[model samples]
Target: MQRDFCDPLGYMGTRGGDVTATMAIVPRIQQVRDCAAAAGLTIIHTREGHRPDLSDLPENKRLKTARAGAEIGSRGPLGRLLLEPRPGEIVIDKPGTGAFYGTDLHHVLATSGIQNLVLVGVTTGVCVTSTAREASDRGLNVLVISDCCAEPDPLEHEMAIRLLQIEGGYIATIASTVDFVASVNTLAQS
Candidate 1:
């Protein structure tokens, strides 16, 4: 977790690398996906990248990026980070940092009767924080597993946690991968 991938040197204004847009939670994302499968919890993914045609992104966001062409459907290194969801898993292509912004994700969660959103992904200060706040605003219970997210700035990451614990909708629950896995396994046995 202490590698350059987990370090701040990677995420923010830096550019041009295989990991520029790769999911920081790739390993844990896979673990969460599998655990959700065993626990009968629906696994959903929110993608932040836009299409290659730039049809999906607004002009303002594109203008601010180091490379204007780094959306999901493009041929850039960032575009290659998205993993295809499983057959039944849902993927919401979001135009913004927050998953619920300008998307029917809340509707889908309600339709599935998902009262709890156990969130996991990249950029703790940006995407993860935004998603958690939005989920709280929408009346969903948000449990953010600390080990499953990464941020460019360590201070930002800590600030994100503090903000979530203090003002985020519900009290944000933190857990390690080992603890989470063990809890899931216990549930399975019960």
Candidate 2:
């Protein structure tokens, strides 16, 4: 999780947004990421950011960020508006909420033969759910780790996950960090 979204001294927290629940999922996300890496699964990270000049940011989003006192592309505690990915990590910088919206995500997935996607990110009702829906619409099997995602409002997060579970699993398949890791281990051994 980026400092802007989860850090108490960062954007969301400084603006009176509660980030306690979001910060709590970091460890769970790490566990899931490690399990996937050990299993040799493709790991792609997405970060919300705009160009340094803010040319690519939409007007509505730009206004919102300005209101929050964390305008996109401006410097933050994480070096930039978004946290930089480590070397060798496949990170996709997204201008919008959905990762595949304006990025080469589909090409990357197609080239890598990635028919399934494991998603873990913040703001369950927003970014996380957007990516999940995008993946589902693109014919990718989506699994959202319940314990590995967070939103400022606990009730909204719960409702978002519940909505995805409706229609007999139409959108995404939900799992816990423990269950996801176990499944990865089982697949690795098979």
Whole-model lDDT for model 1 versus the true structure? 0.69
Per residue, candidate 1 scores C-alpha lDDT tens digits across 1-190 of: 2122332343333443334322456687678768888788888888665655768778777666536343334343222234567888888878898999878899999888998888877777778889988888887888887767766555667787778888433656767677788888998998
Task: Please give each candidate's TM-score.
Answer: 0.78, 0.93
Highest TM-score: which candidate?
2
The list of candidate 2 runs beyond 4 A from truth reads 78-86
RMSD of 1: 4.5
| lDDT (Cα, tens digit) per residue for candidate 2, span 32-144 | 87788778777888888667787788989888888878777666765433334555669888898889998999999999898998888798989999998999999999999
What's the number of clashes in each of the models?
A: 0, 0
